[model samples]
Target: MTLLEKLNQDMVQAMKNKDKDTLSVIRMVKASIQNESIKLGKEHLTEDEELTILSRELKQRKESLQEFTSAGREDLSEKVRFEINVLEQYMPEQLSLEELHEIVEQTIQEANATSMKDFGKVMGKVIPLTKGKADGSQVKKIVEQKLK
Candidate 1:
């Protein structure tokens, strides 16, 4: 099913189960998707667009979780962690570390990235290949290690 359809179904299920946390997260994601469509002047978003919105939402929550944890706000951090879990249920299956390493190695080979100077070239190819499936920071770390 499409992401929106899945979201709608889950929203209904959450309501029936009286899952406030899950319901709130789904609503936020739906709003973000709708706002992105409106901003782009499109009636519907492609799968890639939807994934992009989801990724952005996930990134924001993760960043907030980090900030809250560092600031000793355990209560807020726990809530954000819950939100992250809810959001992740909608995301694509994450790439395994070994799989990510393989992709990085292959991309580096293809780009002939001999040193850190070729970082951009390697990343440009790798990001699109792994987008939404792999975390950008992890990809960067892999690419850096491969190049060096």
Candidate 2:
């Protein structure tokens, strides 16, 4: 099934099961997807577009988790962590560090990115290859180290 269809089904299941947290998160995701569709002047989004929205949501939750933890708000941190967990359930399986390294190495060779100046060139090629599978920041760090 499509991502939107799956989200709708899960949303209904959350409501029926009285899972407030899951329901809230799922609703927010739907709203984000709808907003994105409006922004693009389109009636529907592709799975790739949906994954981009999901990734953005996951990034926001991660930032919130860090902020809450640093502020000593354990309760808030816990809630954010739970939301992160829920969001993660819909994300593609993350790439392992080893797998990420291999991809970066291959991209570097393919892009002939031998210096830091070639960072963007390498990233432009790698980002799409690793999208939804690896975090951009992680991939950037790996590329930087390899280039150095």
Candidate 3:
């Protein structure tokens, strides 16, 4: 099923199951997708666009979880963590270090990136390759290490 359809189905399930936390997170994600569509002047978002919105929301939750934990707010942190877990359920499976490294190696060769100066070129090619499957910062670090 499409992401939006899956979200709608899960939202209904959450409501029936009285799963308030899951329901809240789903609502937030749906709202973000709607906002993104409106922002881009599109009636419907492509799957890639939906994934981008979901990634952004997941990043925000991770940051909030860190902030809450650092501030000694265990109650808030736990909730944020739960939200993170819920959101992650919809994300593509993350690439492992080995898989990411292989992609980095291939991208460097494909782009003929020979030095740090070519970092942008390599990244431009790599980002789309990894997209929702891998974290950009992690891929960047790997690319930098490899190039140097």
Badly placed stretches (over 4 Å) of model 3 are none
lDDT of 3: 0.94
The TM-score values for the models, in the order shown, are 0.98, 0.98, 0.97
- Give me candidate 2's TM-score against the actual structure: 0.98
Which of candidates 1 and 3 reaches a greater lDDT? 1
Model 3 C-alpha lDDT per residue in residues 11-130, reported as the tens digit of each score: 999999999989999999999999999999999999999999998998898889989999999999999999999999999999999999999999999988899999999999989989
lDDT (CA) for every model shown? Answer: 0.96, 0.94, 0.94
Error of 1 at 120 (Å): 0.8
Model 2 C-alpha RMSD to native? 0.7
Instruction: Give the clash count for model 2.
Output: 0
Superposed by TM-score, candidate 2 places the C-alpha of residue 95 at a distance from the truth, in angstroms, of 0.8
Best by lDDT: 1
RMSD of each predicted structure:
0.7, 0.7, 0.8
